[model samples]
Structure formats: structure tokens, C-alpha cells
Target: MRDTASPAPERRGGHPVATRAAARLDRLPPSRWHRRITLVVGIGAFFDLYEIFLGGVLAAVLAAQWNLGHTARSWVIAAGFLGMFAGANVLSVLADRLGRRRMFLVNLGAYSLFSLASAFAPNLSWLLALRFLAGVGLGAELVLVDTYLAEFLPRAVRGRYLAYAYTFGFVGVPVAALLGARLVAGHQLLGLDGWRWLLIAGALGAGFLQVMRRQLPESPRWLVVQGRDAEARRIVAGIEERVAAETGQTLPSVPEAENVPERRVPLGEMFRGDYRRRTLMWWVFQVLQTVGYYGFGSLAPVVLTAKGYTVTDSLLYAALGYCGYPIGSALSIPLIDRIERRTLIIAAALGIAACGLAFGFAAAPWAIVAFGFLLTVCSNVFSNAFHVYQTEIFPTGLRSSAIGIAYALSRLTSAVLPFVALTVLTDLGAAVVFAGSAVLMVLLCLDVALLGPRSTGRSLERI
Candidate 1:
């Protein structure tokens, strides 16, 4: 239970709430619970990614089941993103005001229930409406998970830990793709369409996890902001004890009232000075990168089929593309803390451009597969690196809101790209589509590299 007796803990040394939380976490060991928290959060994130990728996986199946054209399928896939944009932007402010843990649980429950409803949709319109509603929950869940992890983990291990969690989380993409392929590749079950079964299974799986997540504690830092230092101390002490027993090292001393001065952050301060610039840069980067990234991945099968591959071959090829997610996640671990985030992001973006061009122009099937894999690898690298970068840039007081705003823009841009890609590629050809994406990547990379700060290895307060 949250402590109700003490005055809210003061923000230490004028640092943001998250930075203070990060500092406190530095005192603990990297223990089983620590790893478990990371894993559980990743699991939750996996379901989030599952929902995002499921739309793409179901598109081909939906087309066949409904006898719809490419345009209609594109709209269905885009609807989720449209819903996500609204959720991220609207709920993020509430996260700051109401509290992270509260909002997190609400988002999870909301999405899970709506997703379950989607499984029973009688027609395309019903399915699309349910998907959009579920997407709002999904959008908030993604932002909250990132914020929660960043707050709870120590800075020393934040990059690598987050990388591992995200890598494993994204492994859900391949899981969803492979499962959808196998299930839908055959006859329907229980007289319900195979595609409907896929939706039901995913919804039920996510709902189960949300139920389990109630065991999770709220962020101690949020408690501190509400003037519950004693409660915050109790939670931190438990974590420290567990970590010490697991790692066989004494936990470092937490700074006490005698050792450090107190500070507080007013909500309106984010709009002043350098923070405003940083916020704008993140928003722009997210919007452009998402468009380039999702536009390619969401349409991978369609693009491949357009190049003359059979349906089985296209699905297999798309699976190969999905594999790049985990690989990219794993590869980013070592580089995340070692390299400048700005540099890594720029390189990843340029690599995406090169791979996109290569994929568009490749005539041979093997060459297309190879280039598609490379593109996904680079795209994930850019994505994971930015995920860490953006969260680390803001203070705890506004972290969720900032991330939510930026993430919302990304979803908005992504929502439009599928329709745009379908329309443009129809008349302009795959080469032009790929080439246009390449140009966007290059320009966005330059903008971020030149304007964005180097965030790796820095304390959140310093950032």
C-alpha cells in the first residue's frame, strides 16, 4: 500500500523525478527481480507489438475473406494507428496528473477488453471499429512501459536492459507472423473464420497478462512526488535487499535529507528554454522515422508479391523480414551505451535508405530477401536507439507526456503512409516508392544528427 503519513518526498538536487529514481536504483544490484521486472515489462510490450503487427499479418487474410481490394485492406490496417494517435496524445497528460502506474493499468485493461470484442466482430466495419478502440489502449501502454522501465532501472544498466527487453518484446512480431501464417494457411476452426480465431487468441493472451500485471507496484518516484518519502524508502529498501541477496554485494547508500537539497518541478516548465527545442526534435524524428519504417514493413508482403513471388513465398519472405527485429534489438545492446545516440541514429537511418533502395531494385528473389532483412535490421536499430534516446531526454515530471506526444505523431504519420503507399505504388512503381522513402530517411537523419543531443551514458537530469 502507498504511504499516507509522510510529506511528499522532495525532488533531490533539482533533478527530474525519473532522474532521482534512476539515482536511487543505482544503489541496488542487478538481481533476479530486476531481470524479472524487465522480462515482464517486455512481455507486456510483446503483446503491444503483437497488436501492431497483427494488422499487417491479417491484411492478406482479410482481403481474401471479404473479397476487398487493396484500398480497403489498407484502411483497416491504418485505423489502428489513427486510434493510437488519439490515445497517446490524450492519455499522456493524464499520466502525469493521475500517476504512471494508474494510467498504465487502465490502458492495458482498456485495450485488452476491446481486443477481445474485435474477435467477435460480425463484419469488416465492426472489426475496424473495435481495432481502433483497442489501439488507443495500445498507444498509451507503449509509452507507459518505456517510461516505467526508464524510471525503475539504474542508468548504468538502463541501455542494455532496455535493449534486451525491447529485443525480446519485438520477438513477438515473428511469433505473430509465424502463428498467423500457420493458422490461416489452412481451414477455419469451430466454424469461425481462421482470421477471427487469430484475433481472439491474441486478445485473450493480452488480457491474461494484464490480469497478472496487477501485482506490479507503482513507481516509487511518483509516490515521492505526492510527498510519501517513507513509502518510497520502503519500496527501495525491499528492492535493495533483494538485489543484495542475489548479487552478494552491499547496496550503496541512498542520499538522505542531510546529504542533499530538495527541488520540485512545475508542470509548465517544459515549454521554456532548451527543453522546447529538444521536444520538437523528438516529435519530428518520430513522425518521419515512423512513416519510413512502417510504410515499408506493413507493405512488405504486398511489395514482394508485386515483384512476382507466390503467396507462400511472400509470407515466407515476410517472416524473414520480421526476424530482423530481434537481431536488431540484440545488436543494439553493446552499441547503445558505447556510441553516441545521435551518431547511431544517423547511421541506422542512412542504412535504411540504402537497404530500401536495394530492396526496391532487386530482381532476384534471394536478393530481395537479403535486402529486406537488412532493411528491417537497420529500421529496428533506429527504432530501439530512439526509444532509449527519447525517454532519457525528458525529466520524470513530464517524461510520459513528452514521449506520448512524440509517439502520437509517429502513429499519425504511420496511419497515413499505408494508404499513400498503396495509391502511389500503384501508379509510380515500387522503385519510386522505395526511392522516395530513401530520400525521407536521409533528410530526417540529417535533421536528427544535427539537431538532436547525444543522450547515451548521461544522467537524465544532465540530459
Candidate 2:
């Protein structure tokens, strides 16, 4: 492939050195170096997804072991999300102030250490505390992933590669589900309960991921934003050389881009000027989308149990449905760069609304699995679009902070959603729960269709 530079002028928010560095990195064709970076980041992210879905499985096991009621079970689920809220808002601020790579390492270590600690918790209270701490670490993860990938990847292939990375990460969902089904069935590993084994495995995997992440170069775009232009030039040059050697071709010339003076953007800058509208749009989108995405994911076993499945049967069925996460993400890789991001989110939201309703009313076993699978597929497609979309809208100066604040709201919704969702499920029934989701999706579709910017094929600085 002849890699051509994006015609979008990289104006505002960066110096000429920044513009040149971004242009050089963005003009290179996708190569082995890019793929390796994608895979490493994706694998690290796999543990985050594992932890997210792990809550659903663990909630079932803990309930059985402790004989907890609806409210208690809701607490078990909400603890991690609440921690995530704190992590996303607090640690993400550090990511912008400190550096993407520094916060990346910090959050991963926090999640891993706390997860290991949670496995040893002797009671519900301790478990909740540990999970919250772990979540604080996890909160910054996906936010960092979006910020990091957007900074490193070229414009032409940015959305597609981001989808590819998340596709690898989403594989953790079904794996956690299947493992939960098998392990949670009175199974043990290393003399611990199956559920404990799951937490341990996630922590151990993250330990290995930390080692892999050491090989990754910091984002040159970020370095430029930090006024470290000399270092940024060196890193961009290395990237260009490696990509050229792998592609066995001369690299494209860097396109002309406007140079704006670099300065530290204040945290409050997200709610001012053009960013205020973008921030509000993202906040609304994040809140509603969480209700649609994690609403089903966090409550999968509960939803299935409501339909008369035993706990064991619910886990098994949930495993089958979770298979759609990776499958749907993989299927969307080709379409991510091709379609307008907002359009994909809108279409995917509608799909979730439709499939979620069907899943709610499904009686027969086969029907449940089918609709569950389709619903998850749509959820992942929606997930991929928004993850990439949010990062693209903000400049490097505030990308991490903007996404963190916006994404923290989603975590907040996830924290509170279980209580609300479960209460609705208990009162009105499962169909009404999905009907509520349908309304949220309709609102999301309208929000994006009206307010979302066009991001496909545009450079990060330009967007």
C-alpha cells in the first residue's frame, strides 16, 4: 500500500515540531511495528475486560456462597464501578499531568495488586473494599488505551486498528464467562475457590502485560504536546525508519500542517469554546451508552436468572452470549474506518435496543442464546465506535483528561445502574428493562446524529 498523508491541516494546539512529528508518524503505512504495538496494548487491555465481566460471574458465586439478597448483590457489582469512577476522574488527571505511559503503568499495577488482594478477602466487606481499590486502577485503563492508540496510530488506519486492538481485548469477556462457568462450579485451583482462581489469573496476566508494555514507545504526539519536541522527533524518526524497513518502500512526504503554539490546556478547558459542546455530547453519550452496554453485561446472569434459569444455567447461558463480544468486534474492524463513527454508534444502539427486547422475552433456551449473542455483537460494535470517537474529538493536550472525565460518568452510571436496573427487573419484569434501554438508545441515536462530528479518515490533530 502506498501510504499517503492526510490532507487535513494539523492546525492549533501544537508547535511546528509537533505538527511535523505527527505528520511523519501519520504518513506511514501500517506495518509489523504497528501491529505489534496494537497486539501488546490489546493484550494488556484483555485483563481490564476480564475484570469487568468477571464481576458478573463473581456476583453469582458470592451470592450463592454468602446467601445475599438483591441489594447485597448490587453492592458487590457496584463496588468496582464506584472505584472505577474515582480512578477515571483522578488518575486520568495524572495521566495528562504526568504522562500517558507513566499513568498506564501506575493504573495497571494498581489493578493487578488489588485484584490479587481481593482474591484473599475473607468476607463481603473486605471483598468490596478490595474490588473498589482494584477498580480505581482499572478506571484509567480504557481511557488510557483510547488516548495512547489515538496518539500513536496514523489517521488512515486509526479507527480500524483501534477496533482491532479492542477486538483482542474483548476476547477476554467470553474467556472470563467460560472460565466462570467451569470454575465457579465448585472447582478450585491452587486450593482456592474457582472464583478466586479467576481473579488470580487476571492479576498474573497483568503482571506479564506490564513487561510487554515496557517495549512500547511513548506517543510522539503527546511528547510534542509536552514541549519535549526534541525527544518527539527522535521517537518519530525511529518509527518512520522501522515502518519503512518493514514496508520495503520509501515513506511518503510529510504534508504541510499549521503550527500553533503549545501550552498547557487547563482541566476546565473541556467545558469551554468548541470543547464544551463536545464535552456535553460525550457526557450524555457516555451516560446513556453505559446503560445500554454494561447494563446487560454487568447483569447478564441476573437477567438470565430472572427468566427462570438456575444460577449454573445462567452462567452457562451467559457464556454462550458473551461469545459475541470478540466476534462482533472482529467483524467491525473492516467497517470502523469506512463508516462514519457517529452513524455506526447510532445503528449499533438501535440494534442493541431491538435485540435486548428479544432477549428479555426469550423463553426457549436456544432463543435466549441467539438474541443474547446478537445483543452483545451490537454492543461491541457500539463500543468500538465510541471508544475511538471520544479520543478523536479532543486534542492531545486534553485528550486523556477529556476522555477520563467523560468516561468517568459512564463508570458512575455503571455503579448506580445495577440498583436501578435490578429494581426495575424485580418490579416491572425483564421486558420493561429492555424497553427502557430502547428509549436510551433512541436518545443516543438522536444525540450523535445531530451533535457528533465527522471523524473518519481525519488526522487526530486536525479532528
**TM-score top scorer:** 2
Q: What root-mean-square deviation over C-alphas does model 2 reach?
A: 3.1
Candidate 2 residue-wise lDDT, 1-463, digit = tens: 4443223233344436677777777878899999998888888779888888888888888788889899989998899999999999998888888898988889899999999999999999999999999999999999999889888888899899999999999999989888888887677777899899888898888988888787778887778778877777677778887888899888888767656444568988888989888988899999999888888888999888778888889989999999999999988898899999988999999999999999888889999899999999999999999999998898888989999998899999999998998999999988899889989989999988888899888887777
Screening candidate 1 with a backbone cut-off below 3 angstroms (N, C-alpha, C), the clashing residue pairs are 7-227, 8-227, 8-228
RMSD of each: 3.8, 3.1
lDDT of 1 by residue, 250-292 (tens): 5665543222222345656567787888877887788778767
How many residue pairs clash per model?
Answer: 3, 0
Per-model TM against the reference: 0.92, 0.96
Distance from true location, Cα of 167 in model 1, Å = 1.1
Q: Scored by Cα lDDT, where does model 2 land?
A: 0.87
Q: Which stretches of candidate 2 lie over 4 Å from their true place?
A: 1-15, 259-262
The superposed Cα distance between candidate 1 and the true structure at residue 221, in angstroms, equals: 2.2
